[model samples]
Target: MPLLESLVKRRKNREPLSYITGKAEFFKRQFSVDERVLIPRPESEQLVAQTINYVRKLGIEHPRIADIGTGSGAIAISIALEMPSAEVFATDISSEALKVAQMNAHKLGAEVEFTQGNLMGTLQGKFDLIVSNPPYIQSQVIKSLEPEVLREPRIALDGGPNGTEVISPLLEEIRKKLKPSYSAAYVEIDPPIADIALKTAQAKFSYAEVSILTDLAGLIRCISIENN
Candidate 1:
């Protein structure tokens, strides 16, 4: 009751619900969360699940994968836990966020290589699969977002004027990092930006096909691009 009451107070004060609860669910697993990181969203789990399925379809053993902007390591750790043979690289811009990701990885007993860098700056070698739920919210909309999201790291939410700020650079980096014969790349984005995201992906990867995936709420919340 005490904890519940405290959480209620914090919610009343506009603290993110995930921060008050100290945990968020993703891919059927709960992970520790706080103001330092973005709360794991359900839509992201779809990306992870789809990516895992894609990996399995490729019939590739011990596939290498990268999860960029891995806030709580939910995407990377979830994939690692499900696919034991996968080598997962989780990267984040903030050292503080990486700490939370490390803790989650430890709790889940998932072996993930954590790196500190913006996007793929510190990454080397190509990955069989690359996935991200990068910051896609436009800067102007950040201030107007629900209180629950306001507490998250701004860097993890602000996607610049058109919400494709980080995405533009990320797509370019992905083009360079992923091998010519990769399986798929999954990205989560606001439903409204789905078309633009797909266009961006298609511009870079000729074989890319973007599909709009709906969340539990029936909202198109994820964009899966398969590069054959």
Candidate 2:
């Protein structure tokens, strides 16, 4: 009963239940999470599902996959576990977040290579699939977030003046890192920025198939760019 009271006290303080429990479920698996990382969301699981579906559809026996801004290793580990034949790599700018990601990967027994870097800047070679759930929240709006969300690491939320700060640079870098043929990138974004995200993706990959994907709620949630 005392422990329950302590949990209730933490909840009253607006701390995320995931943080208090030290775990968050994603893609039907549990991942370790804390203040150092953003809790994995359901929308990101859709991103992973799409990636896996694409890889299977392409019939790639051994695809090279990269997950950027891999908070808590949710997306990376999920993909790695589902598609064990694929070579999975995950990157994050924060070493602290990477530690959480690494721990999750280790605990989940998912074979993922975790690296500390900004987006895809540190990854080498081309990837068959590039996925990211980056910081797309407007910097000014972050302060207005719910208390539980505010407790998440600020660096994992701030996206400069506009919501596309990190998304813009990430798309720019992907052009060089993504395979020229039979490759795609899936980036999660807030619904409000769907138009901007679509435009940015189309501008970056004019010859490729660029489109906005909606989540279960029918709200725009991801921008998908497929190379021809």
Candidate 3:
């Protein structure tokens, strides 16, 4: 009852529920969370699950994977936990977020190599799967977001005027670095922007197919791009 009361109070005051509870569940596991990192959303779990399924379908064992803009290491760590043979690299631009992610990874006994960098800039080599839940909310829209979302780091939420600042750059970089060796890529985005994302992916890669996956709310919450 005391916990519930605290959560209610926090929510009423615009605090993120995860911040009040200090934990969030993703991929059937609880992860530590705070204002320092964006709370892991259920939609992201779908992205992880889809990515895992796609990789397994390709019969690729011990694949190398990279999770760009890894906030709490949810995406990367979840993959590592499911596919022990996968070499997972989790990168973020904020050191504070990385610290939280590192601690979460350690606490969960997930072997994820965490790094601090803007998107895939510091990453090297090719990956069988590259995934990201980058900031997709436009700057102006962020101000109008629910109080809970406003509590997260602005760097992790604001995606410039069009909500594609980080995403555009990340996609461009991925296109440049992606090789025939890599099999698939997955990304999470706002449902309203799914068309723009699909168009961008199509324009960037020839053998890419963008499939929108709906969340429990029936919104197009995740975009999976399979590249040849």
Using Cα atoms with residue i matched to residue i, what is each candidate's TM-score against the true structure?
0.93, 0.97, 0.92
Per-model lDDT: 0.86, 0.92, 0.84
Worst 10 residues of 2 by lDDT: 190-199
What are the runs in model 3 whose C-alpha is more than 4 Å off?
1-11
Pairs of residues clashing in candidate 3: none
**Best candidate (score: lDDT):** 2
Separate clash counts for every candidate: 0, 0, 0
- 1 or 2: which has the higher lDDT? 2
Error of 3 at 197 (Å): 1.7
Stretches of candidate 1 exceeding 4 Å from the true structure: 1-5, 216-218
Rank all candidate structures by their TM-score, best first, as comma-separated numbers: 2, 1, 3
Candidate with best TM-score = 2
Tens-digit lDDT track of model 3 for 114-140: 888888888888888888999888788
After superposition, which runs of candidate 2 have C-alpha atoms over 4 Å from their true positions?
A: none
Q: List the residue pairs that clash in candidate 1.
A: none
- 1-228 per-residue lDDT for model 1 (tens digits): 998888788879988777877899998899999888999877678878887788878788989899999999999999999999999999999999999999999998999999999999999998888999999998888898886677778899999988888888898898888877756777778866778887888888876666777878888776666767
